[model samples]
Target: MKLLFLLKEGFAGFRRARLAVTIALATITLSLALLGLFGLVAQNLSDSFQRVFYQIRLEVFVDPSLSESDFQTLKSEIERIEAVQSAEYISPGAALQEFEKDFGKDLVAVLESNPLPPSFRVLLKTGHSRPEAIQAVVRRIEALKAVDEVVYPENLIRLLDKYFLLGILIAVGLGTAIFAISTLLIFNTIRLAIHSRQRVIEIMRLVGATDAFIKAPFIFEGILQGLIGGLLAAGLLWLAGDLVRYLFLPGLSVPWLYLAGLVAVGVLLGCIGSYLSVGKYLNA
Candidate 1:
């Protein structure tokens, strides 16, 4: 059958251009592996950013003269704000304890009095964790009569926001470069295969073979190369997962779906490369 012949020719093409095929396969594998590694790093950094965002709390210090009843009213008012997730009251005694735990020094023993102010550790909703949102929330809380002051790590949040944007730009630039390089290598590999088989192609043309029939074998060869390279890349990532986790990110994981998608990308790249190369040659 013609199908069997095409398949046979496709596999044979590999032998006809061994070095080119090897270079193409290696290029695809390396490119995809680099992409996978970058993906892992991005995922870990995202997780770390989320954890830091959640830990960003607004320390709402209250007047020491506030009565327990007034404190409860103030707490209710603070919690009623749309952006506020929860407000936990920290009494002077508890604040002193935390200070000692953090700095290893008892303020009461040094000063003979607890100068720590009672405060509400306000956690914002995830949606309102941005610097501008936090600032707006601070403004609203600062208006309350019972609140003496509102403080947060404004500089830290601004720096993180800036860094996150820079990271996105770098990722886009690197990903584009890798994709272009992989496509070029695969295209060159298929072109070399076609050139080496020029005599066979001419003979087939004389024998009344259609362009489709001649192109089918080359396309199949490309798909096969991509398939093999994808599998090798996936296997390499799997084998190195433990080392990656230990050395780079402790909780990093590559999902099966992501690996499957990587394989799909490889196949698509190969098909595209072969199609372009063979079409150009036949047309010329």
Candidate 2:
């Protein structure tokens, strides 16, 4: 009987503060939609970066003086490294041929001899692809007597690492700001709703109503508000994403996880906002 009354009051709170609830729901919808859009952008950019990372390979230039048998042995030794996925030997002739294809000119005609060293084009395991991991691999290769040089885009890797971290920090800062704003908006609205029932709440408290009992209805109302706002926000974000994607990029993929998460965020925020408001009355 008490549970039923709390449930009834929970749903009734929305009716009691219909205007405030409507405004709060709209605010939550806009906030969550923006957050969802940001999440989608972040996810796609991360995917694109991983694709580029997969293309990065370590080029190990070997000492040209080594015998063909010794070179083959060296290649085999490199292949044994744990980080090395595969090491393909690029013979001097093969390198020259590849160069000529790119330049469309015979290098032999321009130079007295083929100066390109025999090298190994090594693909690394995915685990060893980070800027720090690749550095260890470079040190390992450089330690070898057969290797003259280990050529890779060290600067590019460092730049990417720096910028990637910066991007995450910026995103987190922005997301937090948006979250705080949304939280406060809902909190204020819930506070106002509860304020309207101060007399009833005081009477309930005097009649031996536990704090939990008094708080339940407000919590339920806030959660309901959040749920509706979340659904609206998720739908708005999806529609905006779909429309903009079709116009700007023909193949913009929708991440369902992000969309679902946005709705969850909305519900969570609503619950939190309600609790925050009720705490004021209970001094909790």
Candidate 3:
């Protein structure tokens, strides 16, 4: 019975201050929408970087004059390294074929002799894609007897490292700003609702109502507004998902789990803001 009365009063507060509630709802919706968009972009960029990282591999060219047994021994030794995932041997003929496939030119036909060095296309383990890890792996492989040269994309690794760090800092800074602004707006909205009903609060207090009862309805009102705003924001993101993918990231897709988390955050923010606002008024 008490819960029902509190819910009724909460809905009634919305009717009492329709314009203020609308502005608060709109602010929450916009804030959440911006946050969701930024999250999607950051996710896509991180994925792209991971894809590039996995593509990086070391090309270990070995001495071509070794016997078949020695070559196999060298390949096995390279594969035994801690960071090496697998070492695939490329023979002179296979190397010539790959050169032709990549450059659309028959190197063997042009030179009339296959001079391409036999190399091991060395793939690293999952957690060993960074520049430092790759360099450490290279140093170990180069120390082997038959390895002529160990080469990987040095500049590309450094570039990815630099950009990925920059992206993280930017995402954290913007996300914090958006959350702070949304909290302030919701707090002010609840505060205004309390101010508008100041006389009723005093009358209820004089008639023996506790502070808890007086604050319950305003908290409920804030939560309802937040719920509506979250729903609207999630719907907007769903509708814009395809367009965002086309314009920004071809592989971008907003998962249902992410949208659910966004809604949860909105509800939590509303609860905290309203609780703090009402607490301030009651204490004052």
Candidate 4:
């Protein structure tokens, strides 16, 4: 009965201070939405890159003029390496055929012969995705007498490493800033709400109400406010996902679990902020 009465009073207080509550909720929702969007995008980019890199094999171009014995020896040596998943010899004719498949024309018609060189296409295990590892492999392959040239996007690997580092730094900085801002906003809102009912709190204390009884309503108010704000933010995030799917990232899908986690975090922040702010006043 006492709890119900306290809840009713809390509802009345929330009604009386609807404008401030609405503003605070709106701020929280927007901040959470931005944070969620950035996190999802970063995660999706990482997953996409990993998937592409894992399936990609290093193209090791073998020397065209090497003797048959040297070619056999080179293939045998390359296959012995643990990092080398599978190394296969692609003949000049095969390379030309592949080119024709892509270009839809016989380059031989213009050049009189397949000017393309026979090569060893090497596939590496997932562990060898790093530029250093790829460089080491390229050096070993180039050292072989049969290998004329080796080429893989060495610069691209370095660029990816730099980009990944930058992305992590930016994400951490933005998340911290948004979290601090949201915490401050919620704290101030709770403080203002308490300030408005200072007289009522005093009356309750005078009437022999315990600190728990006095603080319960404020705690509930915070939880209710947070739940509403979180739901709104989640709804907006879903809408944004739909818009992105329609306009930009139709093929690159961000996981639903990530969006769900964002809403859960939003709710927790709201409840915790309200509890901390009200607890301070209750102690006072």
Q: Which one wins on TM-score?
A: 3
Residue clash pairs of candidate 3: none
The CA lDDT of each predicted structure is: 0.82, 0.81, 0.82, 0.76
Candidates, ranked, TM-score: 3, 1, 4, 2
Query: Model 2, 1-284: lDDT tens per residue?
Result: 99999999998877887786777777777777777777777677677777657556888999888998988888888888888988999999999999999989887888978989999999898766678889888898889887899998888777777787787788789777866776777677667767877777888788998999988998888888878888897888788878978799665767787778878887887788888788788873
Q: What's the lDDT for candidate 3?
A: 0.82
Better of 3 and 4 by lDDT: 3
lDDT tens per residue, model 4, 33-80: 777777777677768777656544667777788888877888889877
Candidate 4, superposed: residue stretches over 4 Å from native:
2-13, 48-56, 61-80, 84-127, 142-151, 162-167
Report residue 141 deviation for candidate 1 (angstroms).
Answer: 3.1
Candidate 1, 103-163: lDDT as tens digits: 9997878899999999999988887777888889999999999788999988888888778
List all candidate RMSDs to the true structure.
4.6, 6.4, 4.5, 4.6
Runs in model 3 deviating more than 4 A are 53-56, 59-75, 87-121, 126-130, 142-151, 162-167
**Model 4 CA lDDT for position 77:** 92
Q: Which 10-residue window of candidate 2 scores lowest in summed lDDT?
A: 47-56
Q: Give the C-alpha miss distance for residue 235 in model 3, angstroms.
A: 1.8
Model 1: C-alpha RMSD to truth?
4.6
